[model samples]
Target: MNQTAVKRLYLMQVGSMPEYQIPIVCYLVQTDDNRNILIDTGLPEFIPEEASDFVNGQDVVEQLASIGLKPDDIHMVVSTHYDIDHSGRHAAFTKAEYVVQRLHHLDAESNPRFVANRPQWDQPMDRIRLVHGDTELLPGLELIETSGHVPGHQSVLVRLPKTGATLLPIDAVPFGEDFSRNGQDDGKNPDAEAIRASTVKLLELTEREQIGLVIFGHDRAQWEGLKKLPEYFD
Candidate 1:
């Protein structure tokens, strides 16, 4: 019997804020075929004055370099959502194709908050691949539309060889505490019911799939416990 090779996954810590003690990070998945998939880009070194104090100089390019990778090494960039903190430094990966939900792309284009940071994703339309609900990016990697924090928000589910299932709930459940409480209304997304529903859906999927681990977005305590860069979960 021939055995299938498992893809390698890494959690890259890009930046953090002292005030909230939240570390901004991204995930890198190396496919069996040697392709690199980036989940989300961290905040840019220079942000708007309103957010200047929160984000410091932690370059994503430098973070990738620490793992012996470069910006151009990335083949695919997956935007969980168009939030500034998530997609802020996406322009760094110039050669990669961007994957975003159709609804997200539309929302970012019209939403004034997203439009203000448009330069981060100013790449040509040809480089973008707009996916709908529940799209599969690779054999064992799938994008699950969670859509609560934002209209087109999604989470990634990676079926690992030894680890079984690992879910990346980026901002869909910003913190484990929020998940424990059944999610909160952030007022960013008007549909509070949709957010709650998405959270429940994730919980159901987690139970049904027997997910071994869940990486919550902006979870300070959880982030601290995770294996960072040079270290990774197989």
Candidate 2:
């Protein structure tokens, strides 16, 4: 059996917003085979004026540096969605292949709200690798389509050698309270049905795979209890 092993998993607190107190974070997964996979890039300098006070000084590059990594060291960058908070700093990883859903790319390009913040992700389109639906980036790293908050938002699932399974439901299940309720209709999420279905799907997967940990996207309370960078989950 060709079992893939994730050697290390680090959570980088790249940015934060005061309104929610949930630190915007990014996840780095180092596989035994020397692959460095990054999930989401935190907020960019240009955010909504209302969120101006939410900006954290550390950019994605600086956050990666804290763990002895450079932006170019990332082999792949998986965007859970194209929301400014999640995809803003994506341009930093110029050397990495930007993996995103086809629908997500289209939506970001056409949606006026996202288009206004285009400068943050104003990188060459050639760097994008658009996939339809769910796709596997590596042996144990899977991108699960859990769109709800946005038309093409997705989440990540990692099966580690030591940690078993870890589910990152990104904005699809933004907070612990939402996950606990099976899903909540945050005003921003236009499609309540999709959110409910996606959350249910994640719960099913967690139970079936016996997932060891499930990370919610913007859970302030939950984030406080997690081990941040430097101290990783092996």
How many Å off is the CA of 213 in candidate 1?
0.2
lDDT string, candidate 2, 1-234, tens digits: 755567778887777877668778889999887888899888875677744766765777887887788989998898888777787788778799888888888888878767745765656778888889888877778888987778888899987777778999998887877775445965655688888888888888888988989988788788889998888887
Best by TM-score: 1
User: In model 2, which residue pairs have backbone atoms overlapping below 3 Å?
Assistant: none
Candidate 1: what lDDT?
Answer: 0.83
TM-scores for all candidates: the values are: 0.92, 0.91
Q: For residues 14-75, write the lDDT of model 1, one tens digit per residue.
A: 77777888878888887777888999898876788766655654567887888788889999
TM-score of 2: 0.91
lDDT of each: 0.83, 0.81
